[model samples]
Target: MTGDNAVNIGSPQPPQKADVLARVCAALSAGDADTAKAIIDTDYPMVIGTKAQRRYTLTETLRTFYRDGFLDRYSGTQLIHPGALRTLSMLLPKEFPAHLNGKMTETHFAQWELFPTIDHVDPVARGGADDASNWVTTSMLRNSAKAHWTLSELGWTLHPPGDARHWDGLSSWFTGYLTDRPDLASSSGYLRRWLRATRVVQAERA
Candidate 1:
C-alpha cells in the first residue's frame, strides 16, 4: 500500500466533481455569472419556468440574486439547491409585477430546505455584540446526493472530492475551465458582457 505520507508529484490526478461544484458555488458567490453559466451548461439544460406562476429567463434568474448589485441583498450563507431552484423558478416571476423590479423578503426562505447544510450559530461575539455564523449545515452524504442527482439529470458525471483541484486566481481558473468548452463559453459570454456593462454604467454614474 502507498504510504500515507508519500507524495507522488508525477502522478496525474483527474479533476474532482466537488472541486468543480465548489468553483461553481464560489463563482456564484462572487457574482461571476459567466463561470456559473459555463458550469451549468456543462451540467444541466437551462430550464425556464413555463407556468404563469413561475416564469423567468435563466439569465434573469441568475441576475436577480447572483448579479453584482443585488447579491448583497440576499444572505450569502444560503446555498442554492436544485429543488429550491425549481421551486423559485416557478414562484418568483408570477409574484412580481413586470415594472416593479425588486426582490422580496420571503424569497430568502423559498429554497431553504434544498440546502444540504444546516445553519450553525456562532459562539463568538463581535463589535460589542453577538456574532454568529448562519451558514448551511448538512451531512456530507446529503451534499453528495444533491450534487449527484443534479449532474445525473444533466447527463454528466461527477468526479470525487479526493480528485478535486483548486486555483487561487480567478481569471486563470475561468480560462482553464472555459477554454475548451466553446458552447458553454458562448452562453456565458453574454452574461460577462452584461456584467461589464453594468459596471461601466455604475462607474459613469459614480
Candidate 2:
C-alpha cells in the first residue's frame, strides 16, 4: 500500500473529524463491528502499566514519541480516549463544535494526532513477529494510516524513541491533574487505572 492514502500527521492541516466519524459510521453500518471496535478501543493500556505483563519483555516499556516527529504526550487524559469520542459523537453531535466537525482542529488532537498506540514496525501480515521487538509507539492516526503497510512500502522511516528525562509527555501535569480533581477518579476507571499504575511506577523510582 502506498502512503498516498495515509493522513499526514506531521502536516499543519489535520484530517476532518466529520470524515473520521463518517468512516466509523460506515464501518458500523456495514456490519463491520471489528473495524468500529478497533476504532473504539484506541486506549493504550501498556503505557499506563494497566495491561498485564507478558512472558517476555513488552513493547509497552518502549519510550513514547510520535513517529512523525511531533511532540508526544503520556497515554492519559491529555490524549482523548476513543470511548469518550464515540459517546459524544452519538449523543451530542448537535452540540459538537464547528471547528471539530469542519476540519480536524486542536480539540481532535487528543483523539487522533497525539493519542499513543502500539504498532507493529514490520507488519504481521508480512511475517513480522507479534512481539516486543517488532512493535513501536506511534500516534493512533499514523497507526490507522499504516494498516498492514511496511515502512519501505510507505516510504517512511522510523524516528528515534523519546527520552523521558527530557520530555515526560506532561506526566507531571497528569499527576497534578489527578490530585486536584480526585473526584473524577470515581467516575472514570481510565483515570483510576492510570493513577494506580503511575503511583506504582513512582514508588519503584523512589
Question: Which candidate leads the pack in TM-score?
Answer: 2
All predictions: root-mean-square deviation over Cα?
A: 23.1, 16.5
lDDT by residue for model 1 over 111-179, one digit each (tens)? 333322321122112111121122223322343444313333445332221101121112233334444
Off by over 4 Å in 1: 1-52, 66-72, 78-176, 181-206
Candidate 2 lDDT, 1-206, residue by residue in tens? 35879766566564455666677788899999888766544521112212222332211232222221223222222232223343344345556422334266524344566555667776666566676677666667787888877787688876655545445455555666667767755666755665565555445545
User: Cα lDDT of all candidates, in order?
Assistant: 0.36, 0.52
How do the predictions measure up, each by TM-score?
A: 0.18, 0.50
True-vs-predicted CA distance for residue 27, candidate 2, Å? 40
Report the number of the highest-lDDT candidate: 2
Error of 1 at 30 (Å): 60
Candidate 2, residue 55: how far the Cα is off, in Å? 10
